[model samples]
Target: MVGLLGWLISFFVLIALLVLVVYQLMCLADLEFDHINPYDSATRINQVIIPEYVTQGGLFLIFFLTGHWLLALLCVPYLYYNIKTYMDNRHFVDVTEIFNNLNWEKKKRLFKIGYLVATLFLSLFWLIWSSVEDDELGF
Candidate 1:
């Protein structure tokens, strides 16, 4: 029962990570028009995302096969950071208008700090969770 639960958790986490990577790719495409230009379409954005996704998938596979709950948990923050970075770069509003509407520097700083703090907390959780033994689960 425990092994089945662990597999399900890891599988769902892997799916979530894949979704985030796909979203990141869409954001990258939105930010960099050159990636879509017919004349310059050879750019390796898709190639890059694929390799990254594969690497993450490999990690999940190893964790699932080995029943390494900690290793699987560690992937959470790593995926979060990648998604956050993509979101930070892919602002939807016009930059000039956004800047004019508010203190752009302050907003940028706050956002940076927020993401940094979030990433740190997530990493810490992953580390702590990874240390927990499988049988330690409370009945």
Candidate 2:
């Protein structure tokens, strides 16, 4: 029962992360066409960034401590990149600086999209493993 609950939470958290990354991608694409002002685009992307990391960091702790060791390990590389970019002061966009960093920002978010896709796959694997374990245990 507990294992099922943990797997569900992890799965949904991954889904939520996926949504945020996709939104960021859309905002970046819109900015390319001037459909949205740079300030608005940067602000929107910036707003989602922190919450995404916080959720991911929390997910990491939950996964690492709750016996989802493989998933937990998979979270580390991206989380480390998050921390590194943050410490280097390169993650956020300033309204004045947005144009200068637009290309780099897109590259960064693209990498995140790739990471999220991979994470979703591992999460699905986790679900499959959990389902099989539950069946064996008669849960």
Candidate 3:
């Protein structure tokens, strides 16, 4: 039961993070191609960053509080990175510095997308298998 609940919550939060990363990725591409002004691009990216942090932090916190230790443990590294960036007050990209950091920013988003996809798959696999198992047991 706890496993089902953990995976279910993880599934939704992972979906949300995937969307955020992909959106950030699109914004980075546009900024790179001169399709969007640096100010607007930075602003958009910054807009998403806080919510991403909050949502991600909330996800892991929920896991920990709910006794989903494995899931919480899996998320610790990223959470720690997020905390480090926050503590350094460098979590958001600077508008004037956008051009200089474009490649690095894109790579970061790509890495996040990769990580989120991997976690998403794990949650999805459990969700599917659990549902099928439940159906088999007629519960």
Determine the backbone clash count of candidate 3.
0
In candidate 1 the C-alpha lDDT for residue 31 amounts to: 39
Clashes of each: 0, 0, 0
Between prediction 2 and prediction 3, the one with superior lDDT is: 3
- Candidate 3 matches the true fold with a TM-score of 0.91
Q: What are the Cα lDDT values of the candidates?
A: 0.47, 0.85, 0.87
Candidates sorted on TM-score, descending: 3, 2, 1
- For candidate 1, lDDT tens digit of each residue in 1-139? 4554554554554444445444444433443544344222223333444455455556546564766665657656655654665567642333334324234423443553454354345444544464454436643
Top TM-score: which candidate number? Answer: 3
| lDDT for 85 (candidate 2) | 77
- Across 1-139, the per-residue lDDT of candidate 2 in tens digits comes to 7877888888899899889888988898898888999889989989998888888898898798788888789899988988887899877778787778778888887898888888888888878888899999888
lDDT of 1: 0.47
For each candidate in turn, the TM-score is 0.30, 0.90, 0.91
Better of 1 and 3 by lDDT: 3
lDDT of 3: 0.87
Candidate 3 backbone collisions, by pair: none
Regions more than 4 Å wrong, model 3: 1-3
lDDT of 3 by residue, 1-139 (tens): 5557766877888899889989999998999999999999999999999899988998898778877687789889989989999999999989999999999999999998888888778778878887888778877
